[model samples]
Target: MAARHSRKLLRPLLYTSAAAAAGAGVLYISYRPRNIPGLEAPAVPPPGYREGKLVPPSFPSIKSRLEQIQDLKRSNDEEEYDLLIIGGGATGAGIALDAATRGLKVAVVERDDFSSGTSSKSTKLVHGGVRYLEKAVWELDYNQ
Candidate 1:
């Protein structure tokens, strides 16, 4: 009976030791220091960091709608715009802003107020519906 009890205790101890060794091996392999390309700390600090301090970028002041419209008219009379975006909805406004930031002359023409169209009616949910995907596939609508 004593020998049988010791065998049972020894079996558990052996298993526990094996598990601990495996865990340690995994931890060491994962945490080992090694030089990895693109993972190294940048020699030069990124933009906006000066002398170990973060400096926020200065942005131009927001222009009122009237001012923007006047500017648009002035630009239209002076020179042709590189891009003319119709509608000031989320997508259109975003594209306009992106183009303008890239040094392109962009003008956005909205029927009504900005975001008053379909953008304002959005439920703000970002999800891919299986039913919509099925419909798109069945109808051969690649745009969807």
Candidate 2:
């Protein structure tokens, strides 16, 4: 008898919860920003918008870039690289950048896109480091 009464109570509670959820969803959809007036994407081209080229031509053209890749591949097979970094994440990219700055012929090859691992994922907090620092200061822990 008590189980039956409990279930009867649960059914109404579930229905009301579901109705509230649906109403919240409708509210969110109706009240959300369409666009900020000034921030709306320009209909006509904005200043300095190029027609044909996206970036400046002083940067290597597509053909030159392809040729450079071919040449690099050929040379890499024949000649040993000064620094051959395997990944494209923070550590690998940093090492490659450091080596290149030091006048080394650095090559970084990754199975996935750049920063596809740790760098892409969220730490899931704002001011996390600052909070940590505040806690450490409060606790008087220097090692942290």
Candidate 3:
């Protein structure tokens, strides 16, 4: 009679243990790390830290650069700029560069500092125009 009672009690325990073990197995399998092929670390270092070569950033590093920047600021404060760029964004900087290259004096003034706005955000993309690339390809002759 006791053996019969013990067997009945043991049956539920065994089923519970088996179910728990199966759940744990499923969890382990589901959460296991999968092996992906062809994924690799970057081969090239990012700009400014080029392939173990250290490049110092421009700032108050030297006295002459500081003096030059101060002189430019003073000049901007005193007189009107020929090409006054309001922002230090890519567009403004590019315009300034283009104007200066064409022999026009340019001055860029930013409320914050150069590249302190959305220009400094890493989430933004800087890509060559897709249409320009397509046009160049279209113009190319395969025979050449």
Candidate 4:
């Protein structure tokens, strides 16, 4: 008898919870920033990317996002890209950026989260690449 009463109560609670969820969904859809005046929608680029800077994507967690990406790679047959980079280190990322800027179909695959590898592992000073640079040349490096 108590189980029956509990089940009866649960049915209403579940229905109410679902209704609340649907209402929240509708509220979210109706309250988007793009629906407001003088607001621009978010930018999404071709082949699953945002056309923008070097910043890591905003996510709940970098590790979780990377795991999701790995799942996608395992499940989906990706498009044939002109450039496929294997890491998110500085050199790999630079190559990806260069190819993308040149209007090529570039996709970079980082094994770990962005900057989790040799890119940030360097102990050298930031400007150590081109040492003793000529002032007039507009190129400076300390490694020269």
Candidate with top TM-score is 1
Rank candidates by TM-score, best first: 1, 2, 4, 3
Better of 1 and 3 by TM-score: 1
User: lDDT (0-100) at residue 79 of candidate 4?
Assistant: 54
List the lowest-lDDT window of 10 residues for candidate 2: 56-65
Candidate 3, which segments miss by more than 4 Å at Cα?
1-80, 120-144
Model 1 TM-score, all chains together: 0.38
- Write one digit per residue (lDDT tens) for candidate 2, span 1-144: 999999999999999999999999999999997754446444444435367656432433344445646766788455878987887677777667657665578877777766787666554343465578888999988987
Residue 11, model 3: Cα distance from true site in angstroms: 99
Local error of candidate 2 at residue 56 (angstroms) = 11
Compute each candidate's TM-score over C-alphas. 0.38, 0.35, 0.33, 0.34
After superposing all C-alphas onto the true structure, candidate 4 shows an RMSD in angstroms of 20.8
Clashes of 1: 0
Under the 3 Å rule for N, CA and C atoms, how many clashes does model 3 have? 0
Candidate 3 lDDT: 0.66
What is the C-alpha lDDT profile of model 3 across 1-144, one tens digit per residue?
A: 999999999999999999999999999999986753324433343448767998755443434545746867688455656787787777666667667665577867766656667645443222344345556689774432
Please estimate how well model 1 matches the true structure, expressed as its whole-model Cα lDDT. 0.75
Off by over 4 Å in 4: 1-78, 119-144
Which stretch of 10 consecutive residues in model 4 shows the poorest summed lDDT?
123-132
RMSD of each: 14.5, 20.7, 21.1, 20.8
TM-score of 3: 0.33
